[model samples]
Target: MKNIAIMGGTFNPIHIGHLIAAQCTSDHHLFDEIWFMPSGNPPHKEDEVIIDSAHRMEMCRLATKDHPTFRISDYELNRKGKVYSVDTFAMLQKEFPDNKYWLIIGTDSLFNLEEWYNHKKLLKIGAFVIVHRSGYDEEKSLEQQARLRECYNTSFMNVHMPQIEVSSTIIRQRVAEGKPINYYVPDAVSDYIHKHNLYQLGDDHEIR
Candidate 1:
């Protein structure tokens, strides 16, 4: 079975750090292809800010265009309504039964995995590849680790790359302040944002 990695996120503006992480994972992990799935709508707190779904998908496409092994999937966008990890994984499992999907998530996300809708069911649909992130708790008792090992077939991928402190929220803030966001984001994305006049205001704006 072909091993595919699915990296799902809002991707307000895809940056080098994201690209580097995906590249490293694809190379080191020997993944057949890495699909960058942009979430249409996440079930975050009502106060949380999320950009438009279309823009986020476009940004993902532009950011991953150079890499042949990297592809952008608008699966969540086309699904409509609140996107849940369980539903997405279920759909993918049905369509590509011959392929083994590795849902890529950061260590930060793992801490809150239990909060996700039908998280346990989602875990059964496919294996997860959790990327190690800074300040993420690495300590785990043998008993707890054994319990997790028995609970799900998950893999921990230690991504030893430069930790980029910049986040989508920070990028948006910089844009609102008229600060340069060139290096943090891809040139194509930076140009797209300027050309399309995206995320210029402090308001929740997403450039797909």
Candidate 2:
């Protein structure tokens, strides 16, 4: 069976940090492929003004185009309303029974894993891999990893990612302030943002 990993996010604008983390995890695990799944208007992010789903999807395509193993999946987008992780992974197992699936997330996401919609069922549905983020505390991440393992009786793999201090929130802020985002995102994605004038609305309204 091929080892496949799913990296799901809002990906309002796919950035280098995200790319590095995904690539690092793929290399470390020798996974057959990494699927970057961009969500529709998730309930948690509905308060913010998200760009058109097409734009988000296109940016994801541009960002991962060069990596042969990196792929973009529109499975969640095909469905209406909130598409929870549990539902997505459950479908993956049903449809792609021969392949092993892993969910990739960052240290920042680890802290809030239990709060996700039907998170317990989500944990049980597939394996998970956690990568490092720039500003999060590593010890705290390890502690949370231990806590989740004990609480859910599930295991998580860890990947060492470079400390790239970039985020979709920060990138959007820079664009709104008329600053350059040359290295924050892929050249194609950067050009797409300028050509389309996305995220100029304002700063991030992400819930803490």
Candidate 3:
């Protein structure tokens, strides 16, 4: 069976941190491919200002272009409204019935899995690979993993990667303040953002 991993995120602006995590996860030799799925509209981040999905998807594509095992998926982006994890997983399973999938998520998100929409069903859909970040509490992760295993019989794998201290939120803030984001994101992505003037003050426009 083909082992595929899904790395779904807002990817407001794909950064080096995201790439590092995906690469490290792939290094484990468990997955044959890793698909980066950028959400169209993230339900949890509704309060925060999000750029156009097209821009986000382009950034992801540029970031993963050089990696043979990495690919970008617009599954959620093509969907009209709020796209839930369970729905995405179900669609993928239907499309690729013969492949086994693993949902790649951060250690931070693993603790909040129970709060996600259709959480129980999502757990049973596929195994979860937790990517460890710096400064995260190891004990808390263990506790949550044990709890999920006992309650839902969910499978979890932990991957240790070099902690990248940058985030898309920070990158956006820097761009708005006219600060350089060099080395934080791929060169192609940075050029695209600059050429398009994304995240600049008063430039709130959606891609149609």
Q: Model 1 segments beyond 4 Å from truth?
A: 141-145, 153-158, 202-208
Worst 10 residues of 1 by lDDT: 140-149
Q: Which model, 2 or 3, shows the larger TM-score?
A: 3
lDDT rank order: 3, 2, 1
Q: How well is each residue in 84-187 modelled by candidate 1, as lDDT tens digits?
A: 88888788879978887888777666666667898778756656666765565666422333455578754444454557787877887787778999898998
What would the TM-score be for candidate 2 when compared with the true structure? 0.88
lDDT of 3 by residue, 20-109 (tens): 889999999988899999888878887677888888989999899989999899888899878898888788889989988888889888
Badly placed stretches (over 4 Å) of model 2 are: 134-140, 202-208
By descending TM-score, how would the candidates be arranged? 3, 2, 1
lDDT by residue for model 2 (1-208), tens = 8888888888888899888888898787568999999888576886666777799899999999989899999888888988888888889899989988888987767788888889998876657888875677888888888887887876688898777878898988888878999989999999999998887753454322
Worst-scoring 10-residue span by lDDT in model 2: 199-208
TM-score list, all predictions: 0.87, 0.88, 0.93
